[model samples]
Target: MDLPGVVGTFFAANTIKRECQLLLLLREYVTSLTMACLVEDQCHSTLCDALVQLCIEMRSLDSPPALIRTDPASGFTALCNNDLLKQHRLSVRNFLRESEHGSSKKRIDLSLADKVQLLKHLQLPGVSQASAAKKFGVSTSQVSRLVKAKQQIFDQFDTGNHNRKRQRAGKEEEVGSALFLWFQQKISQGARLSGPLLKQKATELAAAEGSEFTPSDGWLSRWKSRHNIAYKKEQGEKQNADFPAAQHWRQHIIPAILQAYNKDDIFNADETGLYYRGLPDKGHCLKGDELVGGKKAMERITTLVCANMSGTEKRPLFIIGKSRQPRCFPRDPSRLPVDYGHSKNAWMTGEWFAKWLKKWDGELRCKRRRICLLVDNCSAHPSNVALTNIELKFLPPNTTSLIQPLDMGVIKTGRVTTEAD
Candidate 1:
């Protein structure tokens, strides 16, 4: 370059590289400038800023600056004097280019121009965020963000079928397509059994595998609109007793209590854990916060409980056997910190219950009134020894939910009431 319109000191190879491409060209120009400063002779945030200014003030555009630097020196004033040069010299001097390829199997086309237009074309063709992410080797969120910026046109997930399949309660597993596929496969295989056969197979599978009892046909039909189709047995259904003392109380005692007291004096009593496992965590949990779950959730903490609204003397008692002492509190100074990691030093076992009963017995003798103890018919509470010591009462099966005062009123709850389920 020779320049008649402009005059000044030629910058030592004054060229733009790795620069902002506002004008939709000069990809190589920006790259070269950045590489010029990036390597042993390369750039930084400051150097890069200077390089951009230098690119804007070359002699060919107009009069050149006397020296290249960030400070507003003599050259800068002289360069800025040319208003035409300032407006057009380096219009595309801000864009930063990134890696040319993406992760997905989609090919990256090296268009001579920037990819914003190509992305827009793909968007107009109904490319989805996930598809665009796959094609561009970016994350789905990145594609979504790009699409939101109008850099591309992306389609959202189709939601019509999902709205159709969401039904009430445990019947949720039955997907439309999965059920259809199951029936289709069944018919295709000549397994068209009658209603009796279908019932029989379902019953057999239910007895054998619990989940398989639900005819796969309906579930497969559900898969058409959704992904999840298989049924999962609810937790602890096997161990749950068909009848609970709380149930008995709600059915018989609560009605009687309701007749006498307007449900408020139907007070119940049950001691719970001070620091049991599965307590609702206190504070907010960040993304990485997790309690290292294991076989621990099912492990019970020993807690004693009794609740009732009726006669004080006829209340049922409960003792969760699996619960043990907390690990946080260090034991006696002489012993190892983990000596009684989860021991009866805290839990009220049968012996402890007997002692506790002895104290209550003393209190009862002083008042000369027989005390009524309302309790659930749990194994530990109903043990021959635990029951013999008190005027024990039991609630009706599953009736604790409705009749339990805790459920009716919301007091300042202390911790997880590990009482019923």
Candidate 2:
């Protein structure tokens, strides 16, 4: 029996149900009063007497639940600490139980064809339910259920191709088709799906179809497994808001640029923010922690990275900061890994980009080769920079995030390598 019913029965049997109820309320009230008295530093003489009387009556009862008694002598800090520990333990246990429930395996029932074969063999005069059960490697109870639903099984066999198992009553073939179509539509729009969000969308679709569809966790889990649906980390990209613009760039602009320049001479540059001294935001933490202790390293710098399509030449990083020179920098500026630039906001500006291009031009002056430099169409990128050896080509708006070779893998890999080093 459930605990509540058992507790009620015990109280009813003892003929002190009312007194037990009163005692519980009195005990709770006394505890709160004592805690309040201690906090206020007021005399709890009357409260102590009431607590003593409640305790005596509770012990005298036929059956008494365990009561936690806290006195002012224990100190308010100790009382609060005990309460915190109790709450923490309870939360941990609940989390573990939920995890176990999600991970637990349920009995997998036989498919319709298997059930039909088992029932058909049992129908043969010589075959007993036990023999059929043994042959099918199922229990006698399962065999009995098959026998009782023999007509339904036959109907399923006749209606279905018998190649696949029958879907559950509520989960029709239509529902699966609808869900698949929804997933396709979402993917086309570049929207990501979590389990809860998917469930909510499914529920909405089912409601619109005039059918009830509240899928269990197990049902969703099995459905995904059957359909080969999986969760994957999506690459972050700026949304392609104008398809025509992107198409124009890819089909016409990029082709024209490539025709004029060799792939080795093609270079792409992009900037990304970095927290040089801090750990990644995603990491392991203790259970129930909302915030981690210790001040986080908030020091940030913007790194303008440049690379070629052939992955041959990686230019020195254009490190933008609030100061002209940070203390961490080497005394000899030319010896540093990065060419330092400064802005009030520590972000790339058109002036800095022009200056960096001029510096790069100085490096390429000896080669006498005019190179195509691909950059994003950010406000910080100069539209009218006059250079002799370099030709600036700004990518179509919003397309650089994924299309640019520097943003796609080169810069990200560079950051990871630098972090590792």
Candidate 3:
């Protein structure tokens, strides 16, 4: 009448015919044993006798008799159910094997950007720590740690290294910080920065800080990745620009000019060359074959752009063409989209600049306004122009690429817009 033996036989048979009756009888026996121990203060022998009687009544009708054995050491009789004991041992072995395999697996690591995205997801309403952990395939404690370290994660976020999984601290972190500040200042002044230049600066900064740090190509690359810095191709003579002169002008000369004039009264003007009918420099061809095309059209024009510091006013573009009256021109010159002028080479000349400045000066005089005009030191832009209503300021020679607003993507944007049209 062993209960475990009777239950194991029915389970092996895969029958549910007597499951409800067995469950009800077991519940009744458990309740009676509890009440007898608590209310009647039953002795140990009385409880054992009650358990044996309950097991005998609960046994199935067709189950084989359970084996009875005596423990020789304790002199106690016990029921032996081999099938139930074997099944229990098998389940325990499987559980232990799974635990060993799961413990041997490696843990997944999240990147800084992934942590940032997790933080964003967690910030949304109605999301709990357990839910976030499940969604990101991480532990709840890991999610909690990330929430606590959110500020540090955000401070270290770099667009260039979004996929980088590890955070590392360098010996020259102080030098990098100072160099990044210098880099930002130079960029604000429109200086064209290169890798070698940055490396030299880093070395100098490290020396100033009394550190024996050598700036290598690898270090420079890591620093660039950390700060999300990139290089851009600079066209024309800007690569060999006078950055020192530009820095001097920005630090000393520009402040005085800015103090003297209001932002609305300050203006900058520059001219850019455009090949109005040029073809695209790229083409598609089959593999192992050269792309061939006809000679590109080089019909070029010069356009002048002028704007105020506050961006409150933009003058109509001044266009210069090679022909005074080209066949494409309408009968009336004033009907053109831009203010039209002409030169032999379709370029701005000293005479053309002087005339344009004088015309603008006259207009300002009529309005009773005295304005400061900033222009780069091109040969066409003269410093000796006599104007009562305009104070002409020329940028430092060879430093136009570093300090001139027109050359700093402004003209490029204009040319792109024109091409799109």
The number of the candidate with the highest TM-score is: 2
RMSD of each: 21.6, 20.7, 26.5
Alpha carbon lDDT of residue 408, candidate 3?
80
In terms of TM-score, which candidate is stronger, 1 or 2?
2
Decide which is better by lDDT, 1 or 3. 3
Deviation of model 1 at 221, angstroms = 9.9
Tens-digit lDDT track for model 2 on 277-313?
8775556667688646667888888999888878788
- Per-residue lDDT of model 1, residues 288-379, tens digit only: 88654344344444444333454343323334343353354455523532112133444545455555566656765776645445555544
TM-score of each: 0.29, 0.54, 0.52
Q: What RMSD does model 1 have?
A: 21.6
User: In candidate 1, what residue range of length 10 has the lowest lDDT sum?
Assistant: 91-100
Relative to the true structure, candidate 2 has a C-alpha RMSD (angstroms) of 20.7
- Candidate 2 residue 72 C-alpha distance from true site, Å: 67
Model 1 error, position 338 (Å): 22
lDDT, each prediction: 0.39, 0.62, 0.67
Query: Higher TM-score: candidate 2 or 3?
Result: 2
